[model samples]
Target: MKTIATASMGVTVALSLVGTAPAFAVGGSFHCDRPPIMEVMEQVDGSSALQSIVNQYLVRWEARNATEQCQAYADGRPYDISCMNGRRDWPAILASVPKDYFGRSNESLAAAVRDEKRKGNGLREAMAYCRSVGAIK
Candidate 1:
């Protein structure tokens, strides 16, 4: 009976793991559009670089409102969308998109990468700056 119980417990644990989403799936592709927000998180500062990128994207999206921002994400170019939490008064867009969408803008992320080099700091430092400015977390 003890052996049977242990086997059941193991099976339960395995099932739990299988039920959850894969970490990579949550992160999605590493395109400029879907930049990795975790890579730039500075826990000490309580800032978010990804949030900054989202804000910039909203600005441009509001101006165009034609999936232009999404296209920019696809094209892998520097584009601004910053506009107060990246919604630009369009809360519905924020609600409809996935939670990961906020941090996946290419323009701010590319800027972060370039800033990393210009400041002569490594990835961690650059990311910290991005977070401090509320760019990505």
Candidate 2:
């Protein structure tokens, strides 16, 4: 009787797993032939050193924002969508910093970037600078 009951439970569990399998397959895909963001940044003339600085800035931004972004996404707020989409522009912000600023410690640079972002100057001003400097097209 115990052996028969065990076999019955195994069959029930297998059926349940099969029924729910499609739920695990949910996610969209993005297809892009262009190089990744960092690679594109590095390919810009005079941007190799700037790319390193941008990487440092991105590491700090991700550390600071990842949790909040994840929570926002979990809550189904559109805010996370905008936030995730905007991340591709961050490298331009780091590149916008005056070259002199690169001499500062990473902490200082990160702080300055955060401050500028808080003041609403980071993305707009940075992208403008990048365009002017030819760091981005």
Candidate 3:
């Protein structure tokens, strides 16, 4: 019975993943017009170079807005959807992962292989810069 339950739970998780909308990861084939907010946030926040000098509350607010803006861009919604929280006048920054080399069919094999790793870092770098600045600012 325990083994059956474990197998059923695994199946349930797999089904849930299949039913969800496609989310592009770093190495995924899906072209992400916008980065996954949390993934980028983790990268940015994990950076040892960044230090917090601003008020804690304000910092948290900035982080929240950054996350919302990224999510909005990913969902094809207005980038300022999270502006209701505060800082409505600010423009949104949508960080994108460039797939030019891997996305095109005309690329050389070497280029495709070389760009795979860079493509992953592209999202992380862009998102980290945009999102981390807000939190650290």
Candidate 4:
């Protein structure tokens, strides 16, 4: 592991790396700092590294949502779609998906969720993925 502190971001990022390149992981939030994530978004889709960044970001968002965004829903109130975790994160997701899986194919966000469910994996798989990154207990 190497410690990197950028002057612009002013945050120290401790990442396990090959040489000095940060190894992206699934289900990580990196303290919600957006630069590293945005940087990865510029990478061409279909790269395994890209997928890891996307997955980890989602899990990180879920962690924040549950601990910090989904309070109303957690209170057992009626489901309010407005506060759903990852509700407005489509760009991040879309930016990281395979080019063919999205832009060229015109995949909508709802359709992607539906496809995940149709494949017999959705929240259940999400929870598992989140756990893989220690985002949740």
Candidate 5:
């Protein structure tokens, strides 16, 4: 990683790079932080289990009402967003999805919610996915 001094929005800032390009900018008029959504997407892409959770949600969303869709997503996983181990919460779930699945989809958040409504899978599947992705064990 490398750091560079730059100016933005009338403020001087420091930018940090990963590999060869800048990844984040700090102490600037405009700051870039990794939103939970993007971060979770990265995590999800890296983990089979987390991706399964997202897929499960998508499947359920196709078959149920909004509330039922949300419920089906949880599948009685104990916590609202966590798997058995409690590491993956709603934010983590959001971050775990693959970026390509959402890029330029324009309404991925809503789409993902809708996907969760199409449920056939259950809590066991979700837990298994979580475990597979190493989000839980």
Candidate 6:
């Protein structure tokens, strides 16, 4: 009878811990140090057209980061949940950009960035494309 009682207590404690673990999970109120892309762009030139494109790129970048973090959390990999939550603001920033600039989807933009990096121009080509879009400008 004593063994049974001890086993029951252990089970209860385990269940309690499982129930409350998420409440104590590491998440909420995190900030990113990533600087505004405009600050970086300003060093080159102050074209408002370029600024808008860079802003959209930043938004997509944040969204990508958030997606990776969320996937990490789901996979039981260590991740900063608070930072991921903060990155969730990407949707709002993305909405501010012209639809044409975004391509078919975020993946397309990611691919484009990757291609730009591969060419060794870094993101200059992408930014120039953004700035050169006469229709939007």
| Candidate 4 C-alpha lDDT tens digits along 1-137 | 22222431231122201112222223232233243333433332433333333444444444344443223334544332222322435566455444544332223343553453344413344444444544444
| Candidate 1, poorest ten consecutive residues by summed lDDT | 22-31
Clashes of each: 19, 0, 0, 1, 21, 0
TM-score of 4: 0.27
Q: Give residue 3's lDDT in candidate 6 (0 to 100).
A: 27
Report the lDDT tens digits of candidate 3 across residue range 21-108: 3323322222223323322223222111111101111223344555656565565565542222222222222122222322233224
lDDT of 1 by residue, 1-137 (tens): 11223443343334222312211111131123322222222111221333333333332333243234334534565434332222244454345333643544445455653443244312234333333443333
> lDDT tens string, model 6, 60-83?
454345445545655667655343
Among residues 3 or more apart in sequence or in different chains, the pairs in candidate 4 whose N, CA or C atoms overlap within 3 Å are: 27-56
Cα lDDT of model 3 overall?
Answer: 0.31
Candidate 5 weakest ten by summed lDDT: 9-18
Q: Is candidate 2 or candidate 5 better by TM-score?
A: 2
lDDT of 4 at 112: 51
Top model by lDDT, which number? 6
Question: Which of candidates 2 and 3 is the stronger one according to lDDT?
Answer: 2
Specify the highest-TM-score model's number: 6
lDDT of 5 by residue, 1-137 (tens): 22222232112111111111211111111112432223233444322223334544432332122233234334643323211122234454455445555433324454553454353434345334444433333
Return the TM-score for each candidate structure.
0.22, 0.32, 0.24, 0.27, 0.20, 0.34
Provide the lDDT at 27 for model 3: 21
* Full-model lDDT, candidate 4: 0.36
* Model 6 TM: 0.34
| Candidate closer to the true structure by lDDT (higher is better), 2 or 5 | 2
